[model samples]
Target: MSLVNAANRFLPSDTPAAFVADAQRVAVRGERVITLSMRHAGARQVALRYELVGAADAPVVFVAGGISAHRHLAANADFPEKGWVDDLVGEGRALDPANRRLLSFDFLGADGKLDAPIDTADQADAIAVLLDLLGIEQLHGFVGYSYGALVGLQFAIRHAARLHRLVAVSGAHRAHPYAAAWRALQRRAVALGQLQCAEDHGLALARQFAMLSYRTPEEFGERFDAAPEVVNGRVRVAAEDYLDAAGAQYVSRTPVDAYLRLSESIDLHRVVPSAVAVPTVVVAVEGDRLVPLADLVSLVEGLGPRGSLRVLRSPYGHDAFLKETDRIDAILATALRTTGETA
Candidate 1:
């Protein structure tokens, strides 16, 4: 038997949500893969690919991450050994699937749903659509990391009643100008690179710059700052090889053309923190170069009393949420549940 069942028992048998289209089997994950098809105002027919695991009756929790994230979120199904948010969410870790209904959805441009970038608002709409399909009146919690954090905050503003708790990691109400400037150059690399019809070189070059911002100077100083290797007539270092590998890997798995579009989406995303009312935890990393600590200070203030600001010191920069599992897990064990609920 499943951990929990008969989730439908909580909803009215004749609820209007019953009008939702039946989910069709799309592909294989661990146990379930379904298509949540809906009409996009501008894009015509659109389907959001998703996967679900854990107790049927447990409060549903949605997980959203970077642009490359997929709906396949099972921990043991080998959904990318190094998935960006994989470390923080799993059966034995924070946001454990054993006790919660974990819902992972593809971003708007994913699965060929749309060819270009859509703002975090577009992604938030997708979540609302999925909740309607599942007949979930309210999510136990919504966890968003990096790019997904923007979507989470936007969802709180647009669909406050649909979520009980909000976890925004490395997100701010608006994109920092310094961060936007860096991404602008990265997007230019993608637009200018001519290595293939796909602009493969552009992504590689952009990733080189992204790597610096994703990590902290302390990490580089201790790990690969001085290691050098002969490349052509000159010499290179571990940092160069690392960036090259990261860019190559990213291009191999991600849509080359989608890179700049999504990067721009991050820049264009903005929201008013005071408008969000759901209990929220905004996670900040002291070393995050992309979304600086200064930005988080303003965000916490804007959220006022409803938002809780958590600051962590990590060597991974903005990427700490992916690496600092123990600290994140402890924090989430409290944030995922309400004042009266047990984690």
Candidate 2:
């Protein structure tokens, strides 16, 4: 059988039901996941779905989240609590799925939606696949955080005229040593059978490690400094609670294999500066370890006149894009307005 046939066969017989259940689950949490059927420019007919955050026809802005699978980005998915992107979609936020079509999809993965191969170029092509399906010949803008940022860059490079503006948050044009190192270990962990999928224990631990670098030491120190005072043999501190929440949630929802594949792919990212000429904004978090401030600068500088870099103050590191949703929203709302004019 051909890949497409195999893919269709691999899909659960109850995919329609499963898809509806997933969407409803997100809806209960004030989010929605809409599945879009589209085919790649080639013969590969893909079942693509994106998490919707805003209204339709207001302006289409594609939000790129997980590189592994679309389900991974679901608010109710078995991952750490959904963050900024979720916060932004409510009522009046920038990319409100209720007001504008906010689409976030996953790239092709290695196995049954649980694994993603680092096909950055193909991943970009997949966006075209989605656009074709949505009957959207062009997008008003594109916004991405971290790995999604790289995917957005790829899209802009390959489909420059397709997007009006691009916003890359907490992402780097090139991989840093810290990111590469973690990714290597993650890949090794999966290869050695230490982790089976993105939500596996080993992969969870690996993610926990990566999560540490995504934030700032000072933030942890300040947040945990007071520690939890012993009370009836029970103690709690905001910092400990925060870390536990993030770590526990991620391990529970995300599959180990999917995490490893996506993380590894994110680690190997390298952007062709010249490939991007769209009016772009590279937002760098001050304390981000995964994506250094320098890297954001490089991306902006590389974009020349068409690119501008903005640094935001956040103790949350790379995850700040989610943690600091309100702040990020303000920036995005402003960017969308400005980006249109500039683009």
Candidate 3:
């Protein structure tokens, strides 16, 4: 039986009815959650919730995004909620499921209680295991954005034979020191929140801070240049409200511990670009403060002739991959059309 169908049989008798009901609902949507024993040091096992959509004999393409993204890539008959990257995939989209098998899964430390550190290598290994389980021997391409790009690079480095091409968007071989510093402060904020017994508040604060780095000063200046106003006896800038809303929305979906683990994972991520033999298309946004253009240039150079760089200009900064859909879709089409041979 598929994992989703068999999951209920193993649930403890005392399991909440709501939990069981949710599982059944997911099964109806054709989403599968399977537990895998991990070989990594920090984690013993992880349950990966994944969705495979498309023709039975189509080429498989692995798609991933930042820490916040899950397996659902688009809305369909079973799933009504719009996907995180619905603009880039779906019917008549760049990665249309009608012709391609799209594979995506949740990150291992996404549940907020892993307690163990998760390396990108662990994520790569988990993908390999899932592919083995599904009897997929090779992937036509791996398209990853942000943190997912880091994991894609690791996958290409460790499992080069299993992949044909890679499209890494808004990510680099290592975290920029400035970006790492920002993440460190975010973690400290969460730690402070824990000590104060206000974990969610801390997480929200951290997310608010993250929004600053994820976007550019130019964008902020354009969007929040209005005069500060006094509200409830306190002066507030237009930007503060935007950041607060972003933080609150983030906290509603993300757990405090999950944020901490994934934030650390981004800083801990390191890969030797030269080791990646797969043909790679590196997409960098002009004003992405999180992943500097210089770092991406260095990454492409390090890969020698195996990698090609594509630069795009956007006011959205690091979020260009999510906002500049037309441009990203074009890049995806070109990259996916190429063979595994080095550029």
Candidate 4:
């Protein structure tokens, strides 16, 4: 069934005719918002906004990134802005839109107004509802990075029959305690900033701290080993500028509430690897601080014979999935090919 027809079945009879017609109009590449009943108690219902790209009849592939990522997976005439992961989803890329339909969406707490924590399972259920609305019975593959990876694992466990393959990168079955502690600090910073009416300052500080966790000391040492310089009568370290820029950029686009909620969500994430029956490929970075290599190793082992691990040595730390494009592309190509299809 087409998305319009499927939506008509779920939408109330009193739903406006124009709203239903709008759904039909943007069925392919434009953004579509659907109201879904959530699985958790914090919020029972949510407005999920998603976008579909590529051939209308092609096999569906769900792609997601970190908390900040949105529905735009690739650049097109409709969306001129560069995609968050353009390196992995373009012509002849691993998730090429030529033969595979790409689906992506914003997280529930994206707007930062969430009052309660949302589990990874909640995100998985949201994706399941999206598939149903789009008339997609099963996904060809799910490619997730960071927080998205956690959601993919949950999806594979909760809706095992809804997907054929799972590719989880830079995320494990659960957040490591050390990683959760770092996130707690970030949340505390945001909270303190809110209390002082310095929400933006707190958010920037939180993001600056987050950047440190996403990368490594080795990388910082290599890139910012320059001698401290005095500017405006104050000594400034080389790394301070980079961290400041990252923090400022984050503050410009991310709301304080959203940052706190999502940061807490990441720390609260947990899943049972044994419950995930789908064929899985887990990717780990050599020096990742957030998701320790041991955690990922344990996750693959828990999956038994259905799981495999690929480790990449990189100085980029946890952000290797984003910075090491060529290597990630190669891994994705191999993982996505297991379905006996090419894109």
- TM-score each candidate: 0.84, 0.74, 0.88, 0.89
lDDT of 1 by residue, 53-134 (tens): 5555556788887666666554444232333466676766667665676777666665433555567787787788767766
Q: What is the model-wide C-alpha lDDT for candidate 1?
A: 0.73
Give a tens-digit lDDT track for model 2, residues 196-278: 44435555456556667777887778766874677678876556566666666666555555566567678666778767968
> What are the RMSD figures for all models against the true structure?
7.0, 7.9, 6.2, 5.8
> Model 2 compared with the native: what TM-score?
0.74
Name model 4 segments beyond 4 Å from true.
1-43, 231-234, 338-343
lDDT agreement of model 2 with the native = 0.63
* Ten contiguous residues minimizing lDDT sum, candidate 3: 23-32
* Best of the candidates, lDDT: 3
Q: Summarize candidate 4's per-residue lDDT along 63-95 as a digit string, tens digits.
A: 988987776666665565566787787777787
lDDT of 3 at 124: 90
Q: Which ranking of candidates, highest lDDT first?
A: 3, 4, 1, 2
Please write out the lDDT profile of model 3 over residues 1-343, one tens digit for every residue. 2222233243332322233233321212222344555434543656655666665556789999998887777765555556778899866566877667788877777766587677888889889877776567999999999999999999999899999999999989999999999999999999999998999899999999898888889889999999999999999998998988898888878877778888888988999999999999999999999999999999999999999999999999999998899899988988886355232
Which parts of model 3 have CA positions greater than 4 angstroms off?
1-43, 338-343
Greater TM-score among 3 and 4 belongs to: 4
What is the Å distance of residue 106 in model 1 from its true position?
1.0
Candidate with the larger lDDT of 1 and 2: 1
Give the per-residue Cα lDDT of candidate 2 at 18: 31
